[model samples]
Target: MNYAYLSSLFRKQTGKSITAYKNELLIEQAIDIFKKSNKNITEVSNKLGFSNPYYFSRVFKRVTGVSPSVYLSQIYRN
Candidate 1:
């Protein structure tokens, strides 16, 4: 019925907070964008509504276990 209750239910169901879930989804999108386009990390971060590229990089690393630059390098290397 309320935001906190819904958030609690979501966490119980998904084992992650809403913010974590959102960051994960955003990172997934970032990967897709990286693979499909020539957009740089800053561009992708802005497209995904991150406040800044640095914060986006932090969240991206937190979700994917690598920085955006490293992820891009890995993606292109494979």
Candidate 2:
């Protein structure tokens, strides 16, 4: 199948665009990293293959309703 057709099928099956799904997975990984490691946001973002920390923060906020720094603070507080 072509890229468009596969993307449409993926969206129909998963109810999210491919990029959205990928970002969600990345954010999930980020959460795990935050909980288990001492790495900061930039390191996590780079480890997850994000081009830049700013974009990573944007995606993290979009998926988690909080920025990476805020999420880290919350986790670390507990």
Please name the candidate that would achieve the greatest lDDT relative to the true structure. Answer: 1
Candidate 1 error regions (>4 Å): none
**Segments of candidate 2 deviating more than 4 angstroms:** none
Candidate 2 C-alpha lDDT tens digits along 23-69: 99989898998888999989999999999999999999999999999
- Candidate 2, residue 12: Cα displacement in angstroms equals 1.0
The estimated TM-scores of all candidates read 0.95, 0.96
Q: Global lDDT for candidate 2?
A: 0.93
Worst 10 residues of 2 by lDDT: 69-78
Worst ten in a row by lDDT for model 1: 68-77
